[model samples]
Target: MLPRVVRFDLLFVRTDYSDDDAWRDALAAATAVHPSNDFERCGAALQPVESPELSGLTSAQLVGLPRADYLAELAVADAQTMRDQTVLFVDLNELNKQVGRTFRAIPSQVEPIVANFSIANMDFHEFADNADPDGVFRGFTR
Candidate 1:
């Protein structure tokens, strides 16, 4: 028998190497606007994450729980612990397919990290991508 595992796109950028406005850029990368062709006004709450927030959290913590609890957890996360990691969980299926999405949070010197984690099969694999000097992931894979 196979156990089920939910799959979502996990994107991350290290704050230490990115531009000073990394958080704002990260937020922009998370949004897509093409349903009515207007700016998206609402979506997930962006927050800092560490133990429990990232490790101990369950599927329900993201899709089922109230935003307040999650936000509260983020509020107390040790700023020191969150020093350089910036991560966002997204669903490519939920995004507007009509629009083109380019990954921009990673820097050129930083080789982009792309991977697949499978729970049903209990395995993980990493894929590769080529990056320009500016760090935007152009559609081709290396």
Candidate 2:
């Protein structure tokens, strides 16, 4: 039997753009060609990661977890290592804004990395069935 995987949308971006229409457009355009799933089926109800603080991680160690490409690679690798089917739903809108000018350039930088990984492509709804709807693996520092 396939492993019972947990899933949750990782809003790489903050909540500032949740109400921004232009941001949504850009996000849709970028995600459209992404080798993932149909963004249209991705629902808005998928719980947002509320805090920018990475869970399950201590602040001191987070600074050293990895940087840029390395950090992204770690996340993907960790997900794959799980014994269950796990999906990390990443939201690029807030992510783009966080890096300011670099935001728009992000999809290009991270997409290739994510594509090469064995991550699964799923919508918010599908992910919920796998992961805790209210509990995103925020990585604790402890």
Candidate 3:
């Protein structure tokens, strides 16, 4: 079967109980149960002004670019100070198969795993004909 690639926007914020080990453990547990293919990339957060410059580019232009391109550009532009944020990109075809649902339908299943870490916010963006332009599913916590 063809792989169904999906992009997940994970926001890991620091908490009193949060540490690198805790974050790793949560991600490791999730991957053990729902093994994913290679992580496309991971990087620090990107600033808002950099969004247009990055997202507006065509797929061809985006290809071969480093994952931290936007973050680097933000540093050069000096729009605002960077924050302590970590973002990850992983393809969830295996997880989707295990859950017997598309990425859009499995947010509930994945929420528990994310909750194990110190996640300030999380969102899953599924590109489909019927999905919203912003995102199909999103969850936020303060």
Candidate 4:
């Protein structure tokens, strides 16, 4: 049998928690099992933008903005910058182990956070080439 390639779609819900801090803490805990590179491969980032946009906007234009305004702008910009979906590829046998690892690595308090998120899986198989000319007709008749 061929090794199956499984794809897991991890969907994040922004409103799962009541507050930003709780959500951030939950996310941190959930992602603690994997490194930034892993998340990157899955088309996600653990952190927000590293630098704020400073080239176009003047200091004068940014100076008077409220803290909430800045945060909101950053959120919008970050959302626009990052990929909208995250997908992870794994071997079929490793899928269950990976889930177990993630669950075990996260703190008990944040276990519910991981539970709230959903993972959907898909399996892909590679096409095989037949060596014999009669292989295609093995199960067919004229």
State which candidate has the highest lDDT: 2
Per-residue alpha-carbon lDDT of candidate 3 for residues 20-70, written as tens digits (9 for 90 to 100)? 454444333323333224333223221212233443232223322345311
Arrange candidates by lDDT, highest first: which order? 2, 1, 3, 4
Which of candidates 2 and 4 is the stronger one according to TM-score?
Answer: 2
Q: Name the better of 2 and 3 by lDDT.
A: 2
* Per-residue alpha-carbon lDDT of candidate 2 for residues 20-138, written as tens digits (9 for 90 to 100): 45434434432344343422222221112223344343223333433333222122211121222122333222232321111112232233323333243422223223333342331
64-96 per-residue lDDT for model 1 (tens digits): 333321111111111221333223222222232
Instruction: Report the Cα lDDT for candidate 2.
Output: 0.28
Q: Identify the superior model by lDDT, candidate 1 or candidate 4.
A: 1
Segments in model 4 whose C-alpha atoms lie over 4 Å from true places: 1-8, 34-142
Residue pairs with backbone overlap in model 1: none
- CA displacement after TM-score superposition, residue 97 of candidate 1 (Å): 32
lDDT of model 4 at residue 21? 58
Which residues of candidate 3, in runs, are more than 4 Å off?
1-18, 34-142
The candidate, 2 or 3, that scores higher on TM-score is 2
What's the CA error at residue 127 for candidate 1, in Å? 7.2
Best by TM-score: 2
The lowest-lDDT stretch of 10 consecutive residues in candidate 1 is 69-78
Query: Which regions in candidate 2 have their CA more than 4 angstroms from the true location?
Result: 1-11, 34-110, 117-142
| Cα-based lDDT for every prediction | 0.27, 0.28, 0.26, 0.24
RMSD of each: 13.4, 16.7, 14.9, 20.4
- The parts of candidate 1 lying over 4 Å away from their true place are 1-25, 34-128
